[model samples]
Target: MSISSSGFSWPLRVYYEDTDVSGVVYHANYLKFFERARTEWLRSLGYSQESLRHEVEVAFTVSRVEVAFRSPARLDDQLIATVAVTELKRASLVMTQQLRLGDIDGRLLAEAEVKVVSVDAASFKPCALPDGFRNRVQTVENAASRNPSSSAA
Candidate 1:
């Protein structure tokens, strides 16, 4: 529910369905949380996935993900999911995302480095990111990098 030069932070509450039998968040749900955060980040910049596909004829697909689980997030836990673009290329981008307990600087439950590729929505073939989107991302990334206090952890 906050934004900094570091990234966009989205607050979420753990639901029973997001947990395993032991009440800990299921491993796969972390991916979902990351995805949602990324989506919201794009939305914050005025681009929705749907519009990107239909208007720009581009779609972003996850090409790789490397996650490190530091601690467990249990049911009813208030969490904050963060999305920060680390690297941006013509056809792809890399992001560092984290699930933290309570706040942006709270306990890190899990962190992921994700790479996403832009592709032709209809053919699903690799393609360069649309110019407008790319430009906007560059603006955000540049601003974040300039703000020393908002450096990623």
Candidate 2:
């Protein structure tokens, strides 16, 4: 399987618990996969959700999501969830994610545009992203540029 050059990719396997009775991955499970990828992306940059909340007193919450299911994934399928930062603002970020069949030449299965907002961990109110956090993201973006791939249709 080819790696996504435009973003971080997290590999996953469709397990029985992730599928419906018909053996197809349940639609809601795609959200979980996407979440995991995003979390891993943060970890790759030396951050964790907990650390962001505790150390920086900031947390990220999903503000919006727009998803399109182009195909279904069945049980035992190898999937790759790709996460890319499309836009970054003071208090929010727009990310594009894709779920693809990893072993099948990255055939697209589902895609989503997600907006995540930075907030005060205790108050849960909108807050500016930390400067270091933004810098790290910029670093990742720069690295991804070397092997850029379109996240758009």
Candidate 3:
């Protein structure tokens, strides 16, 4: 997770179905938001679950997750999911994800440290990240690398 790219920033609007009777977004829904951000981030990286299988011969699966709830999101509240790669390994990547509430961005609604493991598509077993992909992600950490600005999550 050493590489940090403004990876993706996706806006999410709270809806009625995402909340409970109290009109506050449910905690579990934060995971859904994180998942969407990660999926899109991967897509932006020119990788997709299906394409990764057919082309790269690999797919990613959740290996670990640790989340902390900080606040509640209310219905109609516009939120932002910011994702960044914080660590990387031969066969896994660690991501730091945050769900910020509204424009104020005062308090985090939720935060997660997620670990994704690369696996061989055919065996569905752990595998090292392909050289091409690994090198591309590593370039972000280079001293002369051009950092991409905040992205649409």
Best by TM-score: 2
The runs of at least 3 residues in candidate 2 whose Cα sits more than 4 Å from the true structure, single-residue gaps closed, are 1-5, 148-153
TM-score, every prediction: 0.90, 0.91, 0.86
lDDT of 1 by residue, 59-90 (tens): 99999999999999999999989888888888
Once superposed on the true structure, which residue ranges of model 3 sit more than 4 Å away at CA? 4-7, 140-153
Give the C-alpha lDDT of model 1. Answer: 0.86
Q: Between prediction 1 and prediction 2, which has the larger lDDT?
A: 2
In model 2, state the lDDT of residue 31: 97
lDDT of 3: 0.81
Clashes of 1: 0
Pairs of residues at least 3 apart in sequence or in different chains that clash in candidate 1? none
Mark the regions of model 1 whose C-alpha exceeds 4 Å error after superposition.
1-5, 103-105, 148-153
Error of 2 at 105 (Å): 3.0
Give RMSD (Å) of candidate 3 vs. truth: 2.5
* Per-residue lDDT of candidate 2, residues 32-57 (tens digit): 99999999988988999999998999
Number of residue pairs clashing in candidate 2, backbone atoms closer than 3 angstroms, sequence gap of 3 or more or interchain: 0
Candidate 1 lDDT at 89 equals 82
Q: Residue by residue across 81-133, what tens digits does model 3's lDDT show? A: 87778888999999889888758744688999999999999998999999888
Q: How many backbone clashes does candidate 3 have?
A: 9
Cα lDDT computed for each candidate against the true fold:
0.86, 0.87, 0.81
